[model samples]
Target: MTDNRQSLADLASLTNQPAPAAPAAQSLPTSEGDIAAPVSNEPVREPMPLREQILDKQGRAYATGRRKDAVARVWVKPGTGKITINGRDQEVYFARPTLRLVINQVFGITEREGQYDVVCTVKGGGLSGQAGAVKHGISQALTRFEPVLRASVKAAGFLTRDSRVVERKKYGKAKARRSFQFSKR
Candidate 1:
């Protein structure tokens, strides 16, 4: 048995193969002090690096969200707030009264203190999606300004990324939500 074990080791070394990890002991105590064998061979993943975690946290704290080809850039500054879209005032650029309403609602701003400056640059999507993107961006920027505000923004559903998108359907379909023509003879 000793010679066989030595031969196996020599063969493994010659083949440049690593020795298999030793199996854990499997004996269990019967009303006596003993160790139980590990039940599985799965290797554990290492914990996240502290520096990476910190950077992730910082990124989340001050991040931008884009959607539907519209980009919303938000910065939180100290002062009576204001909002400018493109090079024009938000109200004039947005024009739609209802969108103004949605933006105000999403940002949780009252008529009195809508003063926080939110400068957004959006392109590609129609007016409505741009407004939604801006709302999401502002919500994220606000959370970065105050981590405690995350719950409030999340509860309002403004902080959540809108994942709804156009879906592709089968080749025979007219559109994503449409069906193929009837083939009754």
Candidate 2:
């Protein structure tokens, strides 16, 4: 009986091709006790291009934000930090200090407070959701106005939209996950 299997060297010789070179061994520590890390053969990646500024004819940056069931359309421009929402000032619209703080969080993180004016219209959802939507809108508008702030704002996590929402009610449950009252007859 003839052996059908061939060794790798035999196959390479039959194909008239050179054997593949073995990977380079990792360098050991030097006399100075500096351990050399294994060098990767992969090519270095290029940095991503920076975002460009987006503006309208009126020199305003516009963005839309959504939180829960609320949606807010915001326009940002260079001016004193006056925020108008639904034809009312922020102080009037968002009476609670916490709500106002939530709306201004993006500015605080980017350290751009009082540099841009914001005009927004929010609809649907509750006051809290509306405040969050406005904050998101402001963050987006600010990024569109100044592309350079994108990295810092993104690092602070204001660029991401909040996806948490109210859960749906199940047919047999009183609430999303709460069961109806159990009773003994």
Candidate 3:
């Protein structure tokens, strides 16, 4: 009993308390079938044939576009003077006259003789996003057409994307740039 007491005191002094027994070690079968196999480090990759098409189609006009909350990129290239979007005519793809005007007037490629082909691929946002993408694409195309036009396009605010994103509203707020309901009280 005294030895037990002395040993207990020694354990308490070493461990700062009564020494608790360690948990039993988990026993595993030593058989070969129980061993786990090593996994391969190589990552799986899928073929992107469409992406090649996207890059090849527009090879020249590289654009970056961003709007309220969406951002897209468009590419345009000058070729045999034919304008097409996703293999269809630009007029048919983008039916909005305002959009077309924005493309032609702002990009300065109105002449049929100087044709601009476009290959635009936009992701995120909606119709407006797509339009912004096209605008950005055209801007890039203009820049590519002549490096001198960059300054003019930049000044016109066409090249620079409107990055003004929507501000987060506070609790009980009405809108991003608006205040809550007003009460004279």
Candidate 4:
């Protein structure tokens, strides 16, 4: 065994390879230590922020939502199912049941309907766009309040903004995608 070990070392020496060095001891700072551990040469990276860090003291989460020309500023808080849009009750503001449903779709998907109170002020765009914007806002605010629900909400695609917009009319066209009457009489 001694001869075998010596032969291995001798082979390494013939190859001009230095013997392996022992690992250096490093100490991590403990709870009792006020002194920080030595910094490494690598750049220190800041920790990514989580959804929980974006909340107000009153447990309200706020988000801005946009759809086409519509923009909505929304606030979400825990309360009996109450939704106000532009100081009017949701039903009153969104006369169409479909529009009202659009605004509440996020809560329904999370199965958290009637749990949060949502209030929003919307401007620009038509009623349909406004409803879509409110849905986007509610989804965002819900995520901020509880990060865990992000998966469900995101899976429903509520987190993604709809990019569809009206196409611009060409100079020679009567309307977008509609060319002027072709008369070769």
> Which number leads on lDDT?
2
Residues 25-77, model 3: lDDT tens digits: 12333475875444579897875332122234536746666665555565667
Q: What TM-score would each prediction reach against the true structure?
A: 0.59, 0.77, 0.52, 0.72
Error of 3 at 101 (Å): 1.9
Backbone-clash count (model 1)? 6
lDDT of each: 0.65, 0.89, 0.61, 0.87
Q: After superposition, how far is residue 46 of candidate 3 from its true place, in Å?
A: 51
Deviation (Å) of 11 in candidate 4 = 33
lDDT of 4 by residue, 147-184 (tens): 88898899999999998988898888899889888999
Clashing pairs in 3: 61-76
Over the stretch 1-185, how does candidate 1's per-residue lDDT look in tens digits? 46666676888899999654333223544456665755778888985442221113323223466666666766544456577777788789889988877666745632324546666677767888888777787777766666555666777778788987657676878887687788899
Best by TM-score: 2
True-structure RMSD, every candidate: 11.4, 6.9, 17.0, 9.2
lDDT minimum window of 10 residues, candidate 3: 49-58
Q: Which scores better on TM-score, 2 or 3? A: 2
lDDT per residue for candidate 2 within 110-139, as digits (tens), equals 898899999999999999999999989998
Model 1 residue 127 lDDT score: 86
Candidate 2 worst ten-residue window by lDDT: 1-10
What's model 3's overall lDDT? 0.61
- Residue pairs with clashing backbones, model 4: none
